[model samples]
Target: MRKSVLLFVTFVLFGLLSSAQQTKISEFDLYGCWVLENKKRPSTNIVTYKLCENVAHEDVKFGSKISLLAFNESEHESTGPLACFTTFTEKGTWEFDENSRIASLYSGHEWLKEFKQLDPDEYASWGSPEKFDKLKFRVISIENNQLTVEIIPKQYGKKRTEDSLE
Candidate 1:
């Protein structure tokens, strides 16, 4: 009986230790710059995503529903003078769930609430149940600390071809 109890306790402790390997969201881990890896929009080229410090928000809504911790708008800058290039500070909050392989982005002010995330190697948004008006993205490559993202429209046809992206 004593040996069985000791073995059970040891197993439980081992399980807990291994589970801790999964990473949780941290401010420092999110502080770095993330380039646009979406391949759909190539003209704008690259974007610098910086997580600003000493910023806060309150009572933020996720998607059309749900609530989450508040995060502030960070700086967004264009790479060059391309007509497609434009930059603006994103007003929202971001969270990363490593185990789920997902990153959640919540935005839209008090009225137009919407939240979305991209799982690892996935380009689909799992927010709304609607089929149309859904935005998806694909990552082409990451080189020299730059990311190229490809946008996949919900509708695919001659009207929205790759060449039309130009």
Candidate 2:
């Protein structure tokens, strides 16, 4: 009976150690400067956004200060610098599911919403309710002093039509 108890205890300790040794995501994996490459606008107005900066991913606390640059089209010509940037200070809880490789965005204290990971290197920006559904950004080749990022528009709504019965 003594030998059997000793063996059981050893097995439990080994199991706990193995579970604790699992890999965890590091801060550097999300730290970088990202840029925009493409976009789609609404009918009423053409709106585009760009982003840049470092993101922090702690145990349960996630935060990032990013710059947003926007562009607008006017008349029949493209306008210059319709751009204004503001830092998004996000303080929330985060969880990463290794099996599905998804990351969840959560704000425990506020009226914010949840965001899911669309791709390995792409993050779904759950913008204002009036904004588009998703913005797909992929990190392209980094050369010289430039980091190229490709932004593909994936959510453009349908248009309305006028029906005439004569």
Which candidate comes out best when scored by lDDT? 1
* Model 1 global lDDT (CA atoms, 0 to 1): 0.38
lDDT of 2 at 70: 22
lDDT string for model 1 (1-166, tens) is 9999999999999999998755353333444444322224335533322122211222211111112233533322323346554333434444544443333444443223232233322323433321222223343433344333344444544356678644
Write candidate 2's Cα lDDT for 97-145 as tens digits: 3443332333322232232322322333333332222223333323343
What's the number of clashes in each of the models? Answer: 9, 0
Candidate 2 clashing pairs?
none
lDDT of 2 at 111: 31
TM-score of 2: 0.24
TM-scores for the candidates = 0.29, 0.24
Best by the TM-score measure: 1
Question: How many Å off is the CA of 57 in candidate 1?
Answer: 29
